[model samples]
Target: MRAAERELMARLPEGALMQRAAAGLAAACAELMGRVYGRRVVLLVGSGDNGGDALYAGARLARRGAGVTAVLLSPERTHPGGLAALRRAGGRALATRQKEDAAAVERAIRSADLVVDGIVGIGGKGGLRPDAAPLAELAEASRAAVVAVDLPSGVEADTGEVRGAAIRADLTVTFGTHKPGLLIDPAREYAGSVRLVDIGLSLPDEAEAEALQHADVAALLPVPGAESDKYRRGVVGIAAGSSRYPGAAVLAVAGALRGGAGAVRYVGPAGDAVIARFPETLVSDQGPKRAGRVQAWVVGPGAGDDAQSVAEVLAQDVPVLVDADGLRLADRDLVRARKAPTLMTPHAGEAAALLGVSRGSVEAARLHSVRELAERYGATVLLKGSTTLVASPGGGPVRVNATGTSWLATAGSGDVLSGLAGSLLAAGLSALDAGSVAAYLHGLAGRFAADGAPMGAHDVSESIRSAWRDVMS
Candidate 1:
């Protein structure tokens, strides 16, 4: 972003970039307000260009007959040109150093219809400063709508880590291109909705992270040809469930049947339950070695103390997907030694276990945690949560699944995802493609099954075909 800004600045006159940003911001704020005239707008000014953008935008609002007040956090370090422009346009400025000024700032926040948060930019780290923390709290408690310039204050732009108090904007108007923090959460939760304003800066085709849309997922889904049969399409092996939890085996097989794979092979102690629920399953209790030929293997869903099966599947040359108990039972050396692709699907808790960190640590810094897990495991890792992320060991762009609802937190959801992803792998997609596409379909299916109501894991599994058809349509 810095490089793109520098290149654009070199070709244009001084202050041109800031002017463009302020104009876009002012327009967005106007649209939000419905009518800017006679509305109360408060600008939270900082010490950098972010403050400059807010002040200039405040000037635009003031010119349109709106009451504008600039609360400068750093009086001596505020933008000179921006402050001059705001003053010229009849916008009032107040400093937070004195108790009286602080009280006035609070009063302004309480009565304002709109508050523009420009206290910190993408470059600012840690959290809101002690002087500015109270203002952030005030804005949050206010009934007024908060609009963030560039990004919300105190968010780590690259990592999306909010270590302390951060502004929760109702809307964030970003400049140039989208930052990684805006797409990934914990910071994404703070940025309510994002609007990107183009500033004519050229960027690279490949980014550090990317979110897949409907068109992208449609192109990656596997479709069978006229001459294709069950073997040609792909057969996926499932080694899940135990006597204690036979339902896991049934759910895994259910998901694999709906996936692109032509056939599903189930090998576990729950063969009777698997055949009863999914009569089409090729059942065998002799284990994965004699479960018939399969293009890929999915291991460890509900296999209580089933480390032997996980090890057996890892020995195979075909692509392997490890999930649930498999994530816990599989050996680190065995996973890293795989010649073919290995995909590990883990929630925050499982990822923390693998990384030897707390679940809170992994949840706080999801981007860092996922990437580190991929690099450490030497395989493709799919870290599932509010925003499911797929990362490969090659250090390319991580794929983020934007679809899904809070209802997906139900039981056996991860099993369905493992079967779907393993089936995709057997169908000739790469580890990255399989993990990302499965996550997309699973999330979409979860949304369809729930539809604002509660749904079981089997409901999500049954909705896969509908999700696939929706994508294909």
Candidate 2:
């Protein structure tokens, strides 16, 4: 973002960039207000460019007959140009450093219709300083709608980590492009709804993180040609489930059926149960070696203590997806030794166990955890939770998925996801594409199945076709 801003600033006038940002910010504020006139807007001004943005934006609102007040945290260090502009445009400034101004500042914020959080910019890190923390709390507690400039104050611009107090904005109006923090959590949870205001900065093609849209997923989905047969389309083999947990294999097969694979072959103790549920499956009691030719294999859904099955599947030349019990039972060395693509799906708890860290630590630093695991295991890692992330072994743009709902936190959901991802892998998608695409579809399916209510793993699997259609349409 800095590079892009710098490049655009060099060709423009000294204050041109700030003016453009202020114009957009003011417009968004006005739209949010519905009627700008007679509205009370309070700006939490600091001694930085972010404060300058709020000051200039406040000046615009003042010109439109709205009552604007700038509460300056650093009285002497406030932006001279912005302060002068606000004062000239009929907006008032209150220096909060003085004890007498504290009551006035509180009153202004509490009674205001809108609060603009410009306390800290993207450059500012490690959360809000002690002096600025109170204002954030007040803004959050107030009934006024809050808007953040560039990003919510106190969030790590690149990493999405919030060490301490951070402003939870109702809307975040960012210039140039979307920052990594806005797309990821725990920072994402703070940035309610994001509005991208293009400042026309020429940015590189590469990005730190990426969120795939419908078009991207649609383009990646496999479609059969006129001459394509069931065998030519690709077959996905399932080595999951035992007598104790037959539903795991059933759910896995259910997900695989809708993953664009031509056929599904099952090899486990739950063959009878799998056949009973999904009669289309090619059931075999013989292990993965003799399970017949397959483009990909999905292992470890409910196979308890079945380390040998995990090993046998890993030894195969085909692409493999490991989930549930397979993640724990699969040998790390054997996974690293695989010549074909390997995809490991794990929730926070599974990830923590593998990384030897607390679940809270993994949840807090999801982006870092997923990348570390991918590099360590020499495979693509899909870290699933509120925001599912897919990272490659060599490192590139990590894919972030947020299409799911809280209802997706049900039993056997991971098994379905594993099967779907493996099927995508069998259908000729790379491990990276397979995992990310599967997550996207799975999340969308979850939303459809849930539909503002409770749902089961089977409901999500059944809704996959609807999700695929929605994406394709």
Residue-level lDDT of model 2, residues 1-473, one tens digit each, is 77888898999999999989999999999999999999999999988888999999999999999999999999898988999999999999998888989999999999999999998988878899999999999999899999999899998878888888999999999988888889888888888889988877899999989999999999999999999988888999999999899999999999999999999999999999999989999999999989999999999999998998899999999899999999999889999999999999999999999999999999888889999999999999999998899999998999998888889999999899999999999999999999999999999999999999999999999999999999999
Question: Residue 79, candidate 2: how far off, in angstroms?
Answer: 1.8
The residue pairs in collision within model 2 are none
**lDDT tens readout by residue for model 1, 236-346:** 999999999999988888888988999999999999999988889999888888888999999999999988899999999999999999999999998999999999999
Q: Which ten residues in a row have the lowest lDDT in candidate 1?
A: 97-106
Instruction: Supply candidate 1's per-residue lDDT for 135.
Output: 89
Could you say which candidate leads in TM-score?
2
Cα lDDT of model 2 overall?
A: 0.94
Shift in Å, residue 5, candidate 1: 0.2
CA lDDT of every candidate: 0.93, 0.94
Name the runs in model 1 displaced over 4 angstroms: none
Give me the displacement of residue 293 in model 2, in angstroms.
0.9
